[model samples]
Target: MDFYLAAVLQGLCFSGLALGIYLSMKIFNIPDITTDGSYTLGGTVTGIMLAAHIPQGFILPAVLLSGGVAGGITGFIHTKLRINALLAGILVMTALYSVNLTLMGRSNLPLLAFANLFGNWALTGSQGPDSLIVLLVITAALVFLLGYVLRTDFGIAMRATGNSESMVRALGVNTDRMKITGLAMANALTATSGYLVVQLQGFADINMGIGIVITGLGSVVIGETIIRRFRVVQPVSVLAILLAGAVLFQLALAVTLTLGIDPTLLKLVTALFVLLIVSLPRIFQSRTA
Candidate 1:
């Protein structure tokens, strides 16, 4: 039971990341590689701050802002300098790798001895609700916030820009600003997830974000596959799909683990899962046609 609960908690953490990726990839039509670096940046920043006696209450917001800044930089380069979005993301991600190292002062940071965001509650013998409760709460808040934001006027403009930049520009909307805002918000959520993850795990590893983009993209694809047939889609439904995909992905991992699969091969599994999910629609369309 504990193992299952832990897996679900971990899934919720990854769900936040998946939501971020979905915003960039699906909503904004942007292929962002900066997520890989931003995830680590969030963890590095949170872990270092906590280790340095910073108040745990501020760590999450700090990490979230750092992520937004990192993503905004990439957006600026892409929009202002007219750089390709893909190349811009790669450049920002490359720079963030060094920045993350500087933030941690090393390749990793240990938070085992530090006061974590949930440490006080845990110390007070609040065993009824573990860190999992915190994870769920954070995830729910993000979902509600994002859902609300996406329904606003600016959000509609952002969505329109994603569908047709030229059309949005003709409508007197600043497409560049929309792009930057969307990217910044997406990466902020990604970083926030990383921050919460490290707090739960009590450690932050620099290499923890390896293949993170792939994993996030896979989760989005999986979610879309599950929810593609919905007749009436809502933001809540989309959020639920994202979380469900994360849980399903973790279930796959659990199955592999039970089968004695090596942990290192998980990346390959994620890639394959993405490939299958992405191709399913085309396959079905062809069959029906």
Candidate 2:
């Protein structure tokens, strides 16, 4: 596959991760670092199930629930134990490394010949971009579903809890409950991305989730820039931009690779991209002021 096309497909796979970050960081105002662990957990579960010949459809719920549990643990520690949110996430993430290894029974699992969601089937093809098309459709559907959910009364309460915990609680909402729910949902979505990535890449590695949060953050930053420029605050608008940001970030990496850049510098480049994303808003605001 062409680098550009592959990048687009790659973007679609990671789009869910971006949405997860947006939910935890931007919406819930929590930096649930459990993302790193839950992501690997998802891939671990998926690889194990697929390699074992489990029906593909039956495995997704397991993947989601696994991530939710990881997130819930983080939320529990943060809310009940009063640990710092970052520390809570770190604790869970650290534990999950061992948990993931136990689940996989090793450091790596290969699905090279396993039938996957992106593999040839009666309804789907195995040609180039087939996975991309599958992922694109799923990603679009998720965006719409997420947009609809965010516009609901419960969703408004969730959003409110993020914006102002006191205000929401005064209105009879359970702030702690909302935070737990939000974090679980965020990590569940993130795990779904891992599920897709492992299948697409044909293997699951114990270290795959390391620093993945940075990639997701970069995508969210890119999306935020577009929204800030247009001043659109709608949930649907945010979702659209996030998806676009994921694609753009992937495309940038693909372009760099195509230009013959050393793969070793990719991490450095990613860090610089994130720095730019973080700084650009402040830079623009200062100039305008």
Q: Name the best candidate (by lDDT).
A: 2
Alpha-carbon lDDT, every model: 0.85, 0.90
Off by over 4 Å in 2: 121-126
What is model 1's C-alpha RMSD? Answer: 1.8
At residue 285, give the lDDT of candidate 2. 88
TM-score of each: 0.94, 0.96
Candidate 2, residue 267: the lDDT equals 88
- State the local distance difference test value for candidate 2: 0.90
TM-score of candidate 2 against the unseen true structure:
0.96
* Per-residue lDDT of 99 in model 2: 95
Per-residue lDDT value at 128 in model 2: 54
